[model samples]
Target chain A: MKMKCTISYDGHLFNGYQVQPGKRTVQAELEKALAILHKSEDKVPVISSGRTDSGVHAAGQVIHFDTPLSIPAERWPYALNALLPGDIAVKTAEHADDGFHARFSAIKKEYRYFVYTEKHPDVFKRHYAYHFSYRLNVQKMREASEHLIGTHDFTSFCSANTEVRDKVRTIYELDWTDTDDGLQMRIVGSGFLYNMVRIIAGTLLDVGTGKFSADDVKGMLDAKDREAAGRTAPGHGLYLWHVYYDN
Target chain B: MKMKCTISYDGHLFNGYQVQPGKRTVQAELEKALAILHKSEDKVPVISSGRTDSGVHAAGQVIHFDTPLSIPAERWPYALNALLPGDIAVKTAEHADDGFHARFSAIKKEYRYFVYTEKHPDVFKRHYAYHFSYRLNVQKMREASEHLIGTHDFTSFCSANTEVRDKVRTIYELDWTDTDDGLQMRIVGSGFLYNMVRIIAGTLLDVGTGKFSADDVKGMLDAKDREAAGRTAPGHGLYLWHVYYDN
Candidate 1:
């Protein structure tokens, strides 16, 4: 049977979402837990919507795995949570269609980046937000993000090491909002390139700090050069907020 | 010159607030940072409003120390923050009058306890909140908290090892509010006995869960026995929210 599960994790503890040899990764942990449930000596492979870098959190990461056990769909989360570490939890579980794939079938993804603008970092929220001690112009950042919406070539915003040749992607939504602690940037898109969201956040921060204007952001998009964009934001401040699938 | 400072700390990394012989503690860390600023051979002693237990946090803890150096009051926070670990930060600093003392002059203290009632704990807030899977009756908890307000002998709520001769304390406020993620209990008091707040939180949780009633809470207070109250709630969920002084 095919099982679909939605999980949330404190990514600070894991190396990343991918299974890396000798490193503690989320995928490795999930596969191990599933293997334990099945009493299998061999490692079980689970597919996730996408991989998140180290120290990046996820509120609603979707994954799917094949299981031989006959446990009810709803009970899978409970069983997995009992075995999972304190930082990782399965939020929901259900049986998926035979053709369903966590990654290939996903239609959209949403990501959020948090920035703490206080002089002194918030002790409690330090782990979840990047403490950027500079004053930000929210109006300028909003205006800059407006230029980033819709379909465009994001090569300037992607990591230089990415092997994927396609730089074109559709950004469904791009906006920023003020939160109690600081500013939060919300971006929904058809897909993202390697380090794309963080780079976008960094670029917008530059705009907020008066280093760049809204027009400069558009110029960077046209340049399609990684050097034209701002530095990539730290991974700790980014969250894989949600993944959407066309059912 | 005497300096008064307001600080906040993520207490998960410290053994506790006090300076234990070989343990990593908040006081020790602060003194170390101070010594670095003074470039002295001896550790500088710091006086805090009160001590917090291991795994507890503080949003606004007051402290004072005498320094031979004459750094401006406003610059002290920036200096100390440069040396202190990421978990601890000096929020503000100012010169104190000769009569001012962090502990002796404190007039009020406020504490907050967070309880995550979700079946699966929130990954992001796991460090700041206690995961309580049981359903709670908010009204019952509120009703029980009312009996706890006003001046009372808090012997039943104190730890067994507490050596303080006076068990009487004035609780100015005791209230609970439902939050988006969970329930938060806010308590303001003139002074708190050792483990008093945790015991109160645990006892109220018991009342909310139907293990005890509002009247039962009153009986336990009158009993004045340590075992009469519910178990002490874990330290991680407790936050020393604020410390107030007449100045």
Candidate 2:
């Protein structure tokens, strides 16, 4: 049976969504739990919608896995949750069509970056938000965000060592608003290259700080060079808010 | 100068209030920070109104420190906050009369404990709440709270390891209220011995669960033995709500 699972996780303790040696990764933890249920070391290969870096949390990370054991879809969430760690939770699980792939079938993904401009450190909110005591001009950041929308070669806004040849990606939406805790920057795109969302967030922050004009993003995009992008924001502030898939 | 400081801290990372060797205690952290400020090998001891256990948190824990430094007492909050770690912050600092003391001059201390009765684990709230899936009777808990008013020899409620010779402590008020998030137990007392608040909370929880009657608390208090009290609740769900002091 092929199962589609929606999960939420606190990424601070994890190396990343991907499994790596000597580090406690989210995939490895989930895989270990799945192995216990199936009674086989290689019973399932869990596939996620995308790789989220360490300290990048998720509210809804879509994933899929195949199992030889027969288990009701309704019981999947409860069964998996019992074996998973405290930081991760299986929110929903159901049977997906045979052709569906958690990654390839996705049409769009939404990411949110949270930042707070407060002098005192928020004791309860430190894990979920990045504190930037410096005052920011949101109007300028919004102006810069407009230039980031639409289809363009985002090579300038990606990590230098990214292997993807197609640097072109369509950003469906880019907006920023003041939330109760801090400023929340939301970006929805068909696909993203390595560090694209974080780079965009950093660039917007630069604009907000008046370090660069909104037009600078245009020049950076025109250059199509990784060095042209702003500094990458720390992964802790980023969240995989949601995933959109074609019906 | 006598300085009054309001400290906010995440208690999960420390071993309760008092300074102890080989342990990371809140008092030790503050003393270390104060030592750095004073440029003295000798630690600056700060007296706190509330001495909470490990894993408990405080949004505002009142404390007083005496120092010969010429800095105004009003600047103590900002100055201490600048030197403290990210986990601890001094919210406000004020000058207190020489007669003022955080512990002896305190009139009342309020504590709040949160419990979640839902089946699902709240990832965001895991550190601050105790999760139990059982159905709780709030009315029963509230009714039971009435038995815990005024002064009493709380030997049954206090832990055996406490160094305090007298078991008599006045609990001014104790009540339970249901919130959108969970059940909140609030207790106001002149002072609390080791594990007294947690034991009271545990006893009230027992009443909520129909294991004991509200009137049974009378017998428990009369017993004056630690074994007669209900189990001690975990420390994570408790918070030092507020402290009132007389100048």
Candidate 3:
């Protein structure tokens, strides 16, 4: 049976979500927990809604793992959390239809990037946020984000190593808000390529810093080349906020 | 010449305040920053008020580094912070009397340990605090802290490997308070042996959990055996809050 789970994890310790032989990854951790719980040496395959890079955190990372245990779905979260480390926690768990796949079934994904621009670095939130010394123009960044909405070729913002042939993807919404903590950039999209969100964040940061304008983003989108965009932002600031799947 | 400086550090990235070969430490980083500013590799020797374990944090950690840069003492914090990494910052710097030393001139040291006594863990504060799932009796902990006040032989609460023969120490204050964030334990002492604060925290935690009585602390103190005390608390939750040096 397919068991779907909503997980929250501190990605700073892992290379990424993907399982590697020697590295400590989130998937590997989950599989280890499952193996221990089920008393089986065979590894259980778990699928995530998205692949997050190293240092990228998640509050609503969705995943699914198939298990032979006939345990009730509601008990999964408490059971999993009991075995997982303090860094990872399962907020909710439920059984899904056999056809449900965490990644391919997702209709939309929302991501948020946090930046701390305060003069004094936060003693508590140093790891969970990105500290930028210079002030940023939220209005300018919002203006640039408009050019990012809608279906278009995101090649300029995508990682060069992305194997996806079609560079086109739909961005349903783009929002920016500044709070007491820092500037928050929230982007919702139907799909995102490798390093796509971070590059877009970097480009928007360029606009916020007055180095570029909204038109520059449009120009880069038209160019459809990775070199046309700004540098990729640090992964630590970005988070996989939510995932939407059509029933 | 003694240059008295107030230093601030994240402390998560460092092994401790002391300098050790092949390890990145707070004192080592400060010395490196001074070396760059002074244009010589081994010119500055850094000394700190106390040594904090790896994963421990500090805000008003005092240190002194001698330099011949001729920079005004008041401007030293600004000068050194610019040269240091994001994790470490110099809060204040001042010239001191010839015999003034950060470690030797210290009269009292204050430390704080943050505990999150919740059913689940806080993702952002995972590294910043110790998460105790069981309920902690704050009143009980505070009541027990009263027993720890004043001068006493704290041999039971000292680390087993401590080299200091003198087990007698004066605890100026010991208290616990409940905050919106979590529980905080504050301790001030004239001087502490190795792992003394952590051991005290551990013993107090046992009192909080109803495992030990407030009056039991006196017997433990009188026993002078390490086995009479509670388990040693993890180092990550401890923070060297500040050090007082008699001017």
Candidate 4:
């Protein structure tokens, strides 16, 4: 039987979401716990909707796995959560259609990047937000983000190491909001490339700090060169906020 | 010159707030940093308003120390913060009157205890809150807390090993509020005994879970015995919220 699970994790502990030998990773931990439940030495593979970089958190990451146990959907979370570490938790579990795939069937994803603009760092949120003491013009950042709100080739914003041939992706929304703590940027899209969200955040921050203008951002998009875009923001400030699928 | 400083710390890393031989403590760190500023091999003693146990955090802990440096009050934070670890930070610093004392001159203190009642723990707050899966009746807890207010001999709520001769203390406010994340208990008092707040939290938790009633709490208070109260809640869930003093 195929099961779909939604999970939330504090990503500070894991190396990343992908499985690697001898390294602690989210996928490895999930598989290890599942294997323990099955009482087998062999690895039990679990598929995630997407991979998040090291130190990046997730509030609604989706995963799918095949299990031989006859546990009910409601009990699956309880049964698995008991074996998983405190940093990772299975929020919900449900039966999925046989044809459903966690990654291929996803229609949209939302990512949020947090930046703390205060002069002094917040002790509690230190690990979760990028502490940049520079003053930011929220209006300029909003103006710059407007250019990013539609389907376009995002090669300039993607990491240089990405091997994917297609660079086009649809961005449904790109906006910023001032939270009580700091600035939060929300970006929703059909798909994202390697390091795309971080690069976008960094570029917008430059515009916010008066280093660049909205027109400069549009020129960078047209350049189609990774060097034309701003640096990639740190992964610790990023969060995989949500993932959506068409039923 | 004497300096008064307000500091906040993530106490998970320190053994406690006081100076103990061969232990990583907040006082030791502060004194060591001060010694470096003074260029002395001898330890520079710091006086804090009070000590916090291991894993207990603080947001507004006040302290006073005598220094030989002529650095401006505004620059003290910048200088000291550079030497302190990431977990500890000096929030503000200012010159204090000669008669001021961090411990003796303080008129009031506020402490907060956080309890996460959900079955699943919050990933972000796991380090700061106590995860209690049992259902809690807030009204019952509030009723029981009312008996604990006003001046009373808090011997039952204090740790047995406490050497302080006086067991009497005044609780100005003992109230609980429901937050978006969990239930938080705010306790304001003229002073607190060793482990008094934790014991009170545990007793209130008992009342919340139907293990004890408001009348039972009154009986325990009247009993004036350590064995009469509930267990001390874990130290990690407690926070020194603020310390008050007259200028």
Candidate 5:
């Protein structure tokens, strides 16, 4: 039977979401646990909605796999949690249709980024937020984000190493809000290229610092060059918040 | 010159607050940083408001030390923070009277505890909160807490290994509130014995679970026996929130 599961992870514990030679990863850990449960020598493959970079957390990452066990829906989380590490947890699990694919079937994705604007570092939240310490003009950042809210060629906002030839993507929503400590940004889009969110976040931060303007952002999009964008933000401050799909 | 400083730490990185031979402790780290700054072979002692056990965090732990270098008050924090580890930070620094002492000058202390009530563990907050899935009666816990307030012999709530002979202390206030992720507790008192706050939190949790009644808590205080109370809660969930003094 086909099984679907949603999981959350601290992200600091793994090298990244993909399997690598000798390095520990989220996929390797999940596959090991599943293989151990199956009592098989062959590796069990697990498909995820997408790959998150090193130190990039996930609140609602979905996956799908095949399992022969007849465990109830309520007991599925418990069964896997017993074997999983403390920094990872299976939030929910259920039987899924045989036709569904975790990555290809997803309609939209939401990501959140955190920036700490304090002059001094915070001991508790240091791991979760990037300490920028710059005087940011949030209003200017909001203006810059508005220019990139619709479908556009995001080549300037993606990593140069990306293999995806099509650079056009639709951004449904882009917003920034003040938190107790700093600023939080939530962006929803149909699909994202490699390092797309982080590059856009960095560009917005540059706009906040008056290094760029709203019109400059539109120019960068028009430039369609990766060098036109600012540096990529660190992965620790990013979170894959959720994924949307049509049933 | 006597220097008074306010600092915060992520306690999981240390063995405990006090300096111990061959153990990484908060006091040892502070003295090491100070001695390095002074470029002296002798250790510089740091007297804290009080000692916290291993894995217990601090938000506003005050300390006092004598320094020969006449650095300005505003620059003291930067100088010390540059030498301190990432898990610790100096929040503030100031010149202090020669007679002032961090331990004896402190008149009151506040503590906060966190309990995650969800049955499933939270991956992000695993290091900072205790997970207890049992159904809790918050009203009963509140009633039990009221009976514990005011001046009383806290022998039953203190650790059996405590060296302090006098266990009499006054609790000024106690409160519990719901947070987005879990339950939070705030407690203020004249002083606290070793493990006093954690033990009381554990006892209150027992009351929430119907293992003991509010009247039974009163009886436990009357008994004045260490074995009369519930087990001590883990140190990771407790934080030394603040210390108050008459300047």
Candidate 6:
């Protein structure tokens, strides 16, 4: 039987989500804990919905693995959490349908980024929020987001080194709200390419700072070139907020 | 001229606020940064409002130092912050009156403590908030705080090893509010004894958990013995919120 788990991890503790040689990664840690629970020398492979880059956090990341052990669903979180490090936690665990796949079965994903707009760095939020002192016109950024709300080819908003050839993706929602200390941008989409969220966050800053007008977003979308958009925002400010699967 | 500076720091990086022989400390960092700004071989001493133990955060900690440089008041924050480490920051700096002292002249001080009530630990807030899963009765805690208000000898709330002979202190206000995540207690007083706020927080938990009643607080005060009170809450949960001075 396949088991599904919802996990939350602080990105600062790990190198990234994937397994890397001689580096501490979230996947390696999870598997090592699972191996101990399973009482097996051979590690149980855990599959994640997606990989987050170094310094990118995830609160609602989904993962799945096949297990022979029949631990109750309610007790799985307690069992796994005991072995997991302080930076990672298993929030929920339950049996998944045989058809369910952690990544392939996901219908939508949400990504959120935090930008601290204050001129002075906030001591408490230095690790979680990206300190961006640049002047931002939120109205202009909102206007620019309106143009990219629907299905579009987001080649210009993803990294040039993205492994995926197809860049067409549906962005269901793109919203930004002014928080007390900074700005929070939440984007929901069918799927994302490599560095897609970070690039979009960076490109929106150009429109917000008056370098590129809201109208230029349409032109950049048409160009389908990586250079047409702005710089890629840092990974430290990005969080994989949620993943949705059809009921 | 004597310059006053309001500083903020994440106490996780410091051993304590005071300058120790070789351990990293908030005062040591501040003075080291100031020594570079003064361009002198001798360390420019930085005096703070009071010493906070290791892992106690401070957002409005005031410091004072006599400086020979003629930097503008507006430029002091930038000048000092540039030289300080990431964990410590100078929020504001201005020329203080001849008699103003960071510790001696302060009229009142506010200390805030955060308690996370969730059964599971929060990954992001681990450094800032104390994780307490014990059942808490906010109303009972509030009633207990009423007895602590006004002039009283807080000998029972302070550590027994405290060097100060006099333990009498006046609490202007003791307020606890239920936040979304947990409970936040803010205590304002003329001054605090060593570990006073933390011990009060711990003792209030006894009241909140039914180990003691609201009326017992007065008896604890009358006892004037540290053993009469409950345990000390962890230092990481406490924050020196602000200092009130006569304008």
The numbered model that scores best in DockQ is 1
lDDT of 6 by residue, A15-40 (tens): 99999999999999999999999999
Per-residue lDDT of model 4, residues A40-129, tens digit only: 898888999999999999989999999888999999888988999988999899999999899999999999999998766567777798
TM-score of 4: 0.97
Q: Find the candidate with the highest lDDT and give its number.
A: 1
Judge candidate 3 at residue A10 and give its lDDT.
89
- Model 3 chain A weakest 10-residue run by lDDT: A118-127
The TM-score each candidate achieves on chain A is: 0.99, 0.97, 0.97, 0.98, 0.97, 0.97
Please write out the lDDT profile of model 1 over residues A140-183, one tens digit for every residue. 99999988999999999999999999999999999998978688
C-alpha displacement of A179 in model 2, angstroms? 3.8
Question: Once model 3 is optimally superposed onto the true structure by TM-score, how far is the C-alpha of residue B72 displaced, in angstroms?
Answer: 5.7
TM-score of each: 0.99, 0.87, 0.79, 0.97, 0.97, 0.97
What are the per-model C-alpha RMSD values against the true structure? 1.0, 3.1, 4.3, 1.4, 1.3, 1.3
C-alpha lDDT values of all predictions: 0.93, 0.88, 0.86, 0.92, 0.91, 0.92
Error of 4 at A14 (Å): 1.6
TM-score for the B chain of model 3: 0.96
Interface RMSD of 5: 1.1
Candidate 4 error regions (>4 Å):
none
Clash statistics: count for each candidate: 0, 0, 0, 0, 0, 0
Chain A accuracy of model 1 expressed as TM-score: 0.99
Residues B1-247 of candidate 5: C-alpha lDDT, one tens digit per residue? 9999999999987898988899999999999999999999999999999999999999899999999998999898889989999888898999999889999999999999999988677888787888888998988999999999999999999989978999999999998887777888899999999899999999999999999998889999999998999978888889999999897
CAPRI tier of model 3: acceptable
Interface RMSD of 3: 2.7
Candidate 3: pairs in clash: none
Candidate 1: pairs in clash:
none
Per-residue lDDT tens digits for candidate 5, residues A153-228, read 9999999997899999999999999878689999999999999999999889999999999789999999999999
lDDT of 1 by residue, B133-152 (tens): 89999999999999999999
